[model samples]
Target: MPRAVTLIRSTALSDVAEYAYAATAPADARLIFLAGACPLNEDGSTAAVGDYAGQAAKAVENMRTALGAAGAGLDDVISTRVLVASARQEDLVTAWKVVRNAFGDHDVPSTLLGVTVLGYADQLVEIEGVAAVLDS
Candidate 1:
């Protein structure tokens, strides 16, 4: 059976389909909380410095890897938190699109954050994910 994930959509919110406000997951589902996914390449180097879109893409790829390690996929995602440095909404929008592409039709709850700096030098975007895995 599929995991019971209910998305509450409202017309009151623009971009509601882009991300839900609330998601209800099956009680029997296994929840996975990931550490913030970084845009580090295989060699632990920042994939792209000062490039919000590239960093977001790399971070989303890492999140997908993280989900696979836990026996889940993008469809299992319940929510995501995206952080972009340099305190610009434009940066957040650019990164958000990358995240949206990664999530595809899932469209679960999400947050875009703007910050002055991140944990790593040359890092501009970070993504954290929450997922649920239900019985097959």
Candidate 2:
């Protein structure tokens, strides 16, 4: 069965269709706590060095992999936290676009944060998400 995801909207918040102010899942949903996903390459090295777009995509891909392990997909994602080093406007926008592509029109609630540094040396983006998989 497909997971039930509902996007909540309020007049106090911005009307961004790609993002939701809040999201809810079924009461019986299994919540999956994920580790921060980074932009790692196939060789286990960090990809998108100095490239926000590539890094964002890689990070999202990692999240997807983690969700798959939990028997869920992007549709099951209810919330996401995005961390970007330096927090440049262009960098944030570039990273966000890549993330949006990964989640498509799911309208997953998200928080974008700017940090001084991340766990990795050259990593510019890190994303963590909470997903719920409902039992049939």
After superposing candidate 1, which stretches have Cα over 4 Å from the reference?
A: 12-17
Q: Write candidate 1's Cα lDDT for 42-134 as tens digits.
A: 898999887899999999998889888998888888888888996777888999999998877788888888988889879999998888888
Model 2: how far residue 124 lies from native, Å: 0.4
lDDT of 2: 0.85
In model 1, the clashing pairs are none
The TM-score measured for candidate 2 stands at 0.92
Worst 10 residues of 2 by lDDT: 9-18
TM-scores of the models, in the given order? Answer: 0.92, 0.92
RMSD of 1: 1.6
lDDT (C-alpha) at residue 85 in model 1:
90
RMSD of 2: 1.5
